[model samples]
Target: MKNRLMITAITLLTAMLLLAGCGGQESSNVASDESGNKTEKDSGKPKVAVVLKGLDQEYFKLAEKGAKQAFKDLGVDGTFLAATTQTETEKLINILEDLINEDPDALVVMPSTEAAIPVLERYREKDIPVILIDTDLKWDGKTTYIGTDNYTAGQEAGKFLAEKLSKGDEIAILEGVLGTDVNEQRVKGVEDVMKEKGIKITASQAADFDRVKAVTVMENILTANPNIKGIFTANDEMAIGALKAVKARNLNIPIIGIDGTSDVLESISKGEVTASVAQEPYDMAYKGVENALKVLKGETVEKSIDSSIEVITKENAGEKLEEVKSILDK
Candidate 1:
């Protein structure tokens, strides 16, 4: 009887431990489900994946910061990532594929080129929402687009140049990658206006938007065309590089660029660059995430959100910069 009692106690203890383990497992699963459903309380917020062209550019870095702030305010996850090169078509495809598999509710991407439509279609096939920034694909698979008006911004830059110059001034253009819409549009806009005013382009070269490359290319162009009166760049990093080359040569040509980064604005204030076309990158990031959240909630939003642009010259650079700082503070 003693042996039988001891065996019975052992069996009861085993059963109690098994029950406790099962209870603990069930509780853990329940907690996970609860956490997942928190966004469903009233205004549901969805996750956003921000895939940029590359991390080396100051413009993209600021964009990521703005996206992070928006995510915090809306209580959603904003996963920020970048490709090694802006033109890495395969890398972007793979990143999007993995992100889609994880089932993030939405994606925001700066399309590497107009040629990335086929990959974007795959995401559309999976019913994953997409937001395009900085650049866009030709096809319309994306849920919405948020970016600067590149053509108009370029036009403003052109106007600034026209005002700064007299008739028949020779200018050189340092272009970004050719096929990308941002580069193409901005270049065309400037050329269209400059040509209308009879401003002749002595040299046009593609720096591929790389700063170091821009410096070398600018140096070579300076060797070939020492009489260039004005220089226009597609982005600020390249603009800075060109400025360095110009300063090294002690040339006093007016230089202008796009993407109003802090460094570029500072350069404008210090007369390193003549001007820049300022795009609302922060607004693009904040609104892109906000729109993604709305889409995941099954709400209808505009297919495109256009942020305005401005021409930042030395005259208004200080006031405009102060205004931007105030906006960022809020």
Candidate 2:
């Protein structure tokens, strides 16, 4: 009888132990679910990634500042990436691929080339929204485009030049990198306006948007057309280069450039560069992040966002320079 009682006790003890173990596991699972809920709530804030063309340029640096400000204001996590050189398409593609792997809530990109379009398509397949800034691509998958109206800005530059020079005055154009939408649209606007004004385009050449290349191309153009009255460069970098070439030759001619970079504004102050079509890169970046957040929240956004542009000349260079400096300092 004692042996039978001992065996029954052992069985009861075993059943109790098994029941306790099962109860402990259920409690642990409940705790795990609670922890997961906390994590989900904490991670509710959207994360955005911004990829620029190149960070070496002052214009992009300002845009970066603006994007940082947007992060601060909107309380979202933001990452910025860029290529070392504007022409480094392969490098840009690699950077973007890495960004895609990160699986951010949204992407803001300044495409270095149209080749970036296919790489960005990967994001679309994953349902990630993309906002394009500064430069544009020929892709239909972009969420929205935020930057200056290049064609209209170029028209403003052309009109400014045409008013200063006579109808028959010969001028030269220092074009940016060939085949890019920014270059093509700006050049087209200039050509249309110059044609309407009866301005003779004595020489036109691509400088690849490099200062050194601009110097060489300007020299060649001057050698062919010595009597060129004025020059219009696609961007401030090329404008600075063209100015260097003209200064070396001891020639005084009106030179207009786009993008009112600090260096270009200082040149304008010194009466070296005639004028520039000032683009609000900072505004573009800030708004781009804002739009990205909106899209992530399933809110409606505009298909196109123009940050606006202005004409900066010696008369307003000091004021504009101060404004730009303030933004960069922030």
Candidate 3:
């Protein structure tokens, strides 16, 4: 009878140990799923998906550099995607949909248009965190926004141009794509400041933020108002185009543009572009990824983060160029 009781106790102990081992394994599997699949805390590094507007532009290239740097620093897996053309909203939306299917731990996006907002909303519905970089959309579902305050940057550009031009001086405006928040706010800021300064806007036309389109638009404006004294372009790409148009006319005009791209800085150094409202594209992208990681880790993060902006002119273009070079080089 004693031997039989001892054997029964040993059998019960073995059964309990087996059950506990199974329970532990199940709990680990649940934990891994709760965190995004393939997360650093579970399997390997967390995967982040970044969808930019277009990769062909200089500004986006700088942003890409920043995103890559963040991946290296944070030890996260990153996949970057972009539309071939800046204005291809359909393509961008499709890319976003495919990324959603992949179900990455986080997403960073620069929406090309308001049309992309609904697609982003779907991500929110699925409980995936998103961070907006560079351009912004009308939606509030994003985890956070990481970019310069474009309206404020536009106001700065206006103030810079206002200082150089006299009241009632005829100036032309080379606008970006229609219906983009960045373009609209920047234009409004410029209009408000120009109105206050009594500066007359000779012409304002949408160039879709394309350099080639800007050249044609600038030529048309010059033809209509050959006496225009100044020009304000929504971005540096358009500014460069306008500069080319002005050069072709053998005219000297103070042209201010946003985005302190290397090409624009070179133009500033050469006294071609008067100044630019320099945006921290690299910082915006880097912080976008960093903030996404924080979201994944359940850490608190600010809803909005301004990467900061600056005014780059001939006086300080060289210094700004070096700073930009350092970011791109890294």
Candidate 4:
């Protein structure tokens, strides 16, 4: 009877200990999103995700500001992410894959290259809205494409440069990524315009849209072709770099570029860079999110939304700079 009593006491202690251990654990607040990702418990807000090519440049920073502002004004649960650099195509693809598993209600992306199209299609299959900004894709899956008409921007910049030089005068072109669609369109636009104006393209080189690389590339071009009359760069960073090389050689010639970044606008104000075909990156990003919200709401959005472009010269560079700063400050 003593042995039986001892066994009963031990069984009772085990039951009590199990109860206490269960009580000591904390409650889980984590809940699954409608698409099965971890999310806040029953928040009425829609989940929106933005992924850019990279945020290393000032131009991309302006885009980030626009997205963040829309996030605040629209009252959605927003997540912004980016690749480390513009060239990190694989990293960007990986980010897209991870975001897909999250299954955001909508997606905004500035594609690094055409490689991102396959990953974006999965969003389409899942019925999640995809909004493309800056660099666009040919995929039918994209809900809408919001950015500048790059070819038009390039044509205008080429026209501005051609006006400063006489026919038969040779000029050089500073390209971005060699075979990328954006670079190709911009370069082709410039080339066709140059052809019409009877201007010869003496040197066409790719600096990958980097300022330092442009400096080195421009230096070599100047050494090889001393009498080149004017220059056109695919983007402002390359324009700024080329300017340094030209100044080093005491060569004064017209140079035009796209992307009316503050640095380029400042140079234009100083009468250094001749002009810039300014794209509205801010508007592109803002409208991207705005349209994404509409898609989520079952409202129709246009397939193509042109954010528009402008030509900034010394006469209006200061005003444009203030406009850009105001948007950034907000």
Candidate 5:
């Protein structure tokens, strides 16, 4: 009886082992997701992770909308993530490293700066495609960059600002974070155009892309140069902040910024802000994921994708605001 029981136990062990061995890669079976969309999660779907700069601002939130929409539309198991703030480089790297271990098939990153290059290289080494959005890194392994031409946007802004001011009229520039390629290019574009138009640049100072910081910096600039005629901020937040500073002193001036956030658009509509060079943050992130999926599927993608830019002024600011609100609603 004991011998019979041992034989039965041995047979059951063999059966269990064979059953375990039969399980191979996950199936790509179609399944109904919670949203009633057909998904491949039941089996295995491509896992793509998107690590954006931060979600602290509306611009990044718009980018987030794009990524999420792209993930659903493309049928990929997308992981959308971001650091709490753009300045949290270390935290962003940590998140990237953890994502690397999970071995996502593709990565879409809107890096804060070049600080993310080494970590991105790891994805390259693993043969995982890395797509950059918003901020472009110098690494050759990047599948592509999808964002606005910051310099061109700046040039447009410069031209716009110059149109209202006479030659030799002094204007101050509120630069974004120093050492950033975005800030540098945008600032350079404005400087070049302003120089071409014979407009005097009184001060170009970094506000670290912080609205409150912009207020402080603008206060200092206004104090130092009380006759500052106009202001051009690298982004809308800084523009709004500078506006606050200008308003506090009852000074009315043309203040143009790059990002066309709804707040900026509203301000423009109300004739509070002069204008904003609108960038498609949502489209940048949307294309970033779409192209990453293409790279995963052994398809060729362009090394660069310009989402497009627009100058939102008082005339169209109200219309643009409605359009923007409709997109975020989706």
Candidate 6:
């Protein structure tokens, strides 16, 4: 009878232990579900890092704004970093490397130089998709480029200048930094059209995309050559600087520049500048983010996205001006 009683006690103990084990397992599963970190998507949204060439320039600031808007709309985590200046190639590359180390889901970059090609290639090897915005590098690793058709935009500016100038009129070119693809392509486009039209370019100089430097260069060009009748500045800031220089000379020189920045558009409306090739930077930003999300979803995006450009002159300045305002309004 004692053996029977002991057997019953042991069986009850075994059953209790098994039930406790099952309860513990159920609690563990509930805790795991509550903690919520099993999958990548379950943890949080993907991350993207946006790197710009510089933050000081108005152009770069606008690009950054676009990027921020894109991130917000896409509902992704994005961080923006900038090199202090366009000439800071090493710093820019370092920034890129640091961001890459974070293992961001994607990167959108505005490269300062072609040397960044290999660095970007590394990102591709790691299976991280990259998008180029505003400026481009010579790498196939990038999934898409979202910005102006810079070459065509330059050609349009050239054509506008050509139409405004008569035969053999002396025109001066204020180029951005040398060797960068954006500046090179823009300068080439202008020179190409100028070559086709048989126009004379009396002076050309690199202003390093600096407004003050552009002003100094324009002043020198004006002082050295009294015959300059027109100016082609690679960017709106430079064009405005040239306008200041021209106005200081008490002379009228037709100026055509790129970027329909609010100030540039205002200059166009005020007849201070002849025209500016307007780049839809905001739309570029919005689309870049939209496309990034699409890319994440395994949707195909175009290898290149030309945000489109337009000539904003006094004739259509009001409409162009309003278009930019509407973008801001949004």
lDDT by residue for model 4 (143-199), tens: 999998888888998888899999999999999987677788899999999999999
- Residues 181-282, candidate 2: write the lDDT tens digits: 999899888899999999999888999888889999999999899999999999999999999999999999999999999989999999999999999989
Give lDDT: candidate 6, residue 246. Answer: 96
Estimate TM-scores for all models.
0.83, 0.86, 0.86, 0.88, 0.87, 0.84
For candidate 5, the per-residue lDDT at 232 reads 98
- Looking at model 1, report the run of 10 residues with the lowest lDDT sum: 28-37
Model 3: per-residue lDDT, tens digit, 59-101?
9988888887787788877777789877998999999997787
- Minimum summed lDDT over a 10-residue window in model 6 is located at 28-37
Q: What TM-score, to 2 decimals, does candidate 3 have?
A: 0.86
lDDT of 6 by residue, 47-166 (tens): 777787787766676676777777666776666688998878898999888777778788888888888887888899999898888887777778999898788988999999999888
Off by over 4 Å in 5: 1-43
Give Cα-based local distance difference scores for all models. 0.80, 0.87, 0.88, 0.88, 0.88, 0.83
Clashes of 4: 0
Clashing pairs in 1: none
Tens-digit per-residue lDDT, 98-199, candidate 1? 667656678888887866677678778878888897775677788988898788878888888888787898888999988788998989999998989999
Clash totals for all models, in order? 0, 0, 0, 0, 1, 0
lDDT of 5 by residue, 1-330 (tens): 999999999999999988876653333233334254655543477777888878988999899888888877887787777999887888999989988877788999999888888988998999999998998777898989999888899999999999999988999999988888899999999999988989999998999888999999999999999878999999999999999999999999999999899989999999999999999998998898889888888999999899999999999998889978987783
For each of the candidates, the C-alpha root-mean-square deviation to the true structure, in angstroms, is 5.9, 10.0, 10.5, 5.6, 5.9, 10.7
Between candidates 3 and 6, which one is better according to lDDT?
Answer: 3
* Regions of model 4 farther than 4 Å from truth: 1-42
Which ranges of candidate 6 are over 4 A from the true structure? 1-43, 322-330
Q: Which ten residues in a row have the lowest lDDT in candidate 5?
A: 25-34
- Superposed Cα deviation of residue 302, candidate 2 (Å): 1.1
Q: Where does model 3 exceed 4 Å of error?
A: 1-43
